[model samples]
Target: MENFDEQFSITKTVEFIQKNKSTRVILQLPPKLLQFSSKIEKHLKKALKNDKISFFILAGASTRHCCVDTVSSARVFGDLIVHYGHSCLSSTAQIPILNIFIPTKISIQNIISAFETEFSTQKTKQMILFYSTEVENSISGLYLQLNKTFPNLKRTLLNLPKNEKEKVKKFEQKQEQEQEQEQEQEQEQEQEKEQEQEKEQEKEKAKEEEKEQEKEKEKEKEKEKEKEKENLKIFGRVLPITDITQLSKNQLIWLGSSTNPTLFSLALTFGAENFLVLDPEKEYLEFEKMERMQPMRRILMKRYALIEKAKKSENIGIVVGTTNPKKDLQIVKYLQLLIKNSKKKSQVISMGVVKSLKLGNFVHDLDLFVVIGCNESLILDQSDYYRPVLVPDELDLALNHDREWDGTINLNFYPNHDMIANLEKKLKQSFDLILIEQQNQKQIENLIISRSETRSFKGLETRLGENKVTKIEEGLSGRASQYQDEIDLN
Candidate 1:
């Protein structure tokens, strides 16, 4: 339904394939975008007509649609991949990818009017701008324009690849260097003679500069580590932002689809009061009503209730909702260890996508389920579930008696050092208590045998309680429907 030529740069994709000299290219699209595959393929083939080049369109991803399908590309022997639709901008280790962000048109004037109407009263409050990745191409235009009117406004930017203009400049520079290669060679001799003359004079200065550079490099390494600690990666998108911790205090202006799940995740992470949704498609700003945020707050309440329910549970089912085992395996094992230390039984189950019906089969076996997956998959609607479901954070709160709830929800499954330390202490205590109980049972058994020594003179009759023999009777042998008790009168 959407125009491929306007929204996506098919020329850029063609240039990328040509640059890479890729014989086999993979075009990975989400399910919604599959219908446009023929049109996309036709355009690509018309633009690039190389006999050796072959194109393959992967209908859907192996895992979540937001994630890049690297495994599929490898299966198809693809050298380059062009991903369509919305992406989390997650870094992939296997293959190089070009993400095509779908852009939607929005009136800058309308947005400014909405902003003024909402924030005209409070001019001092700083706001953070967040938009879905689909509208990323428009965000630069929106951000630059919005900052002209509101000087204090700040927006988080993704670390994107080089633009077409930069690429063109680099290509031109390479061509210019090739053209001037003979001239540069002629000047190289002159430059070498000048370099030799200055080398002796600058030798001592160069050593001192190198030492200072080493010291500065060390300082930079420390700074980078600190930066790494500050950066937060949620739902696979890495946000190198500082204001995220202060989100509860600051106002958030969300620009994207109203039905985006990330919007709800953000609201649940921070309070809903600070959120203002500006839907470009709907062409309105939703802030004053606050009715839309009610469902997210309700989700928070539901998750909290599930935590309480999880605390009382005896058998916990740790559901692995991610296909990537390396990322979630440690989390699953850690949860199991924590539940075990709490004196509860835990079982690890793997499912690509967790469903109510699949989990319902274990309704009789499991008391509650703790899902270990990405941030997007962790928040599930459990209204249809017979048993309650929880994320790793809730599971941690439920199992750990030493820790208290901080009234904040974190969807990231990575546990910190403090939690690990607390779990170790609890484990030691549980083991000590278990050993004490075992010793007490052994002592009670010895005491029972000692007490029975003087009162067992009556032999087997004392323990058996004087059994009496009785005659056996024939048992009824008929179907349940024609049982003796239910027979009709004859």
Candidate 2:
């Protein structure tokens, strides 16, 4: 509530809503900011008088507070969502969102002074400056000051897309995609007509030429694919540095709250050695003298152990953490298929937030759970879950019987054609070995029949002898807050 007007642009939001003519708006606030929800809603309502707009303050988000709760908004038929607090700036949401990032105050001079004090004697060639979204406004100023003070050190700022620009670009990209699809349809029709006309005249020569051209194109495509695979293996949302292969050599300077989870994820992604944190609001250095290496090492060791355990898992559960209808859903389907082909039973379950309590119910059924979520959500504590939870890359490595572990961990849950093909190849190799083994055994059919007979099917006997059934009854309708069945005492 402090500096509410300066921190949150109520006027701009109102004007934008009026311009867009959004009737239903969902205001999503984090747990910490929930106290101010009523105040914010009242101000917005007062400003938008006679606009006939409804504001819904959504609490208890299913996903991380930083990520937009598009699923909840969609449930209420909200046309627009105004998200408060820190944000991951994920562009995968299905609805329009306005992110109002919390601003943190910090003195640029203090950060410069801290940097000078820490590395006064240590000679560092390159440094990568990472900042949280809360302190993004001050990052540029700090970068400028640091550049002026330390001219010898090569500095790089982790550049993410601007909030407004990212949304606009997403809209433009969608429009462009639609236009391209229409153009492709027209081109296909024209090409079909031309092909019909030419089919009778020079059929033999045209067929031969087309075959040769197709072969050349395939060869070129294969070459390009190989090159791309060799050059780019890095995926995930946390792309701090350009050449991530050389990340070990550079010093990492983080500008934001010390408690932010992103810092931990970055530390896990890269090594935590030579990492510094500057709390912008407090204007002081954290972890300056403390030991971060040991904690990071423990995390890596636990994750490595989990990966090893995941290989022996029989019943795997693919946990979808985000509401992304495209990428996350595709990953869930692909993972299920991959596990099935690998001769392991797998199940897909969707959740807004994955917790130990929620997963405890499935502990008896699943041996391990593979989490497909945002970069931050991928890093779960070892003690949190009863069973081992592995990321997509970790699961991929576990299922891969031949690949050797080189102490590299990837948090990429995005859909990649190469990853799928590689896993499929490994599964096929295993299947071939199984086939050879089956050929050597004469009682394969009998063994399969015995295993099938042991399975239980109680559904066929659960029905009662009587054919008459009860009449269908109406259920609760509308939103949970105001169900149709609730009686009005007033």
Candidate 3:
């Protein structure tokens, strides 16, 4: 050999080191450059044949100038320092430091091939290569060569490393300092603008307040005029129920002396022309002369007539009612006689409180009854009829009854010597019944007027009064407190 260096190229350094066994190749590279560590390791391993050869990679931030201090430290520790990506090193590093420079062309090819392999596509039709502006010219030259090799591809150049986010952050901080000074200068101007706007807003607010006061004064004047008109009307008019029978056809009327003011207001608002005062002392026929009747009673009377017509003409009528078993049985007998006396076209049916009528148990078709309860009770008693339903209590008791009957009841307690008028007023907000020591003449008259209006007799059975569905004692004690305690424990 001319000399050892002349005979063997430095490329064979890995093989020479491997031949000596116990050789350790410690690679020191920039932290960012270590992204190629896997490829570097693979290439070095391929160049060495000895099984005893060892490799160590040390990465840090100072590799831009090939960190001399780290190289010396590695050498003192008996490890060969292979500094990658740099062509020079500091003179103070006494250790043997190998400088390796990746060929620019080779680097470009490697990068492109790596990207193609990762993305699984051969089409590099449009690409933009970015690098530090200081190195942009070099990369641009490489891009030109690549374009020649790949004629179908298009390339765009960008200066990137210097424009990276961290680099731009420093520039932004400097600009922000300048902006702060400018903002200080503008602060006085902005404060003056805000104060001027606020003064204008206050002036507008004062104007609006003045306008509102004037509007309120106008509203008061209008209210006084309305009050005067109402007083005049009240003095000129008569009570609605006094001569209700003399009212014209299709005329609306309100009954009852103790009618709710709110209800009266609602009726007037909804359009009622007249009101009819009822007298309980008056007979049913006498009230009919006045053409004034209770709503529920009117429904019952119409239903009764329909039932009778069906029996006389269509030979079909259903009787549905809840009554004492004895009374119900007698009513059914009377209905049977009426049905038998009619023509063959007439059919009479009845269901009593028997509770079990098999084929005849529930009669849905009906003519009339003295005491009919509800739609469900009627359906249960007479499943065969299709007639207009009539109920006592305007179906109030029927609708409000619990699905399952319980035994709890209500007892009315009043102070001593309470009049019916007073008691009725008190109970009006709560209960349906009026409890008093002695009923007033007007109140009794209203009650009788209400009863005569009834075409069917249905009332709450006091024997089986109010009942409780839920037991109070069964509820948990301080359930919410217990929940909070459990949460605190957790």
Tens-digit lDDT track for model 1 on 74-169?
788887778888775543434456788767777767777887787787755777777788777777777887787677787876644333334444
1 or 2, greater by lDDT? 1
| Residue-by-residue lDDT tens digits, candidate 3, 1-490 | 2232222223444643433232666666666568867666666666665556667766543222323334324543644556564322222233344545443222444444444443345344333221221222245555566566444443322211111233234455567668855765576477866577765675688679869967986897799676545431111122222232323332332222222232233132222223332222223211121223224334334544443344333333334333223433443444333333332222333333323232233244433332321112322123343333322222212222222212111111111233323434443533333334235666888898998778476665565556656656644555775843255653
- Residue-level lDDT tens digits of model 2 in 88-183: 655456555776777877777777788887777864447766678777656677777787766545543332333344455456656766896686
Q: Against the hidden reference, what TM-scores do the models get? A: 0.73, 0.69, 0.19
- lDDT over C-alpha atoms for residue 69 of model 3: 31
How do all the candidates rank in terms of TM-score, highest first? 1, 2, 3
Report, for every candidate in turn, its global Cα lDDT versus the true structure.
Answer: 0.72, 0.72, 0.38
What is candidate 1's CA lDDT for residue 149? 67
Better of 2 and 3 by lDDT: 2
Model 2 ranges with Cα > 4 A deviation:
121-124, 152-241, 283-294, 379-384, 406-408, 413-415, 429-490
Off by over 4 Å in 3: 1-22, 61-65, 69-76, 106-490
